[model samples]
Target: MVFMNYSTSTWILILGPLAVFLVITVWVIELLAKAPPWYPAIPIVIGFAVVFLALGVLIRAKLGKIVF
Candidate 1:
């Protein structure tokens, strides 16, 4: 298959964001499904936190600054 011809780094580049997106989508959906009506800000705040955390990770990864 054409996909099989990609290099290892190419595979990681393709799969990393995809995996992050899938996980975040599932997490948000599950939170909304079970969250109470009075707790709407909980998801928004947590979503922002997750977004910042992901952005930090993306920045570090882009800079090749991973410590571990």
Candidate 2:
């Protein structure tokens, strides 16, 4: 049986989510500060959310399984 590294797994999860959250928050804030209520930034926000989610999935996959 292979022993997994819990510390590495934790860091991977934390860093990926943190980075994605920060980026999305910044983007939305910027758009809101500039665009009007009827602007098209809504779709762009959705697209970014999807991309960030996919990135999280990829990060988890790369981290593999953690047994501890």
Candidate 3:
């Protein structure tokens, strides 16, 4: 058996894009389809926040090593 150890930055690099893609996709779909008026706006805001945060992390990771 082989075990792989990944750092925090590495994990973020791996999952960040996937998360952003999924969030954006869902948001788009929601936009195209009709949603209930009761639907909250928090998810959309959170999605954008995640994308920005992920981009920031990726930029920092590429420019220099991440401490944690």
lDDT of 2 by residue, 1-68 (tens): 23353577666665677677868767776777586873667667767777877786676656645422
Q: Rate the local accuracy (lDDT) of all candidates.
A: 0.65, 0.66, 0.64
TM-score of each: 0.48, 0.42, 0.45
Candidate 2: RMSD to truth = 5.5
Collision count of model 2? 0
For residue 1, model 1's alpha carbon misses the true position, in angstroms, by 1.9
Q: At residue 27, give the lDDT of candidate 1.
A: 71
Residue lDDT tens for model 3, 1-68: 11146667777766677678767767765764566663576577567767877786677556534443
Worst 10 residues of 2 by lDDT: 59-68
Rank order (by TM-score, best first): 1, 3, 2
Candidate 1 residues 35-61, lDDT tens each? Answer: 677356666656876787678567655
Q: Pairs clashing in candidate 1?
A: none
Give residue 60's error in model 2 in angstroms. Answer: 2.5
Score residue 39 of candidate 1 by CA lDDT: 56
Q: After superposition, how far is residue 23 of candidate 3 from its true place, in Å?
A: 0.4
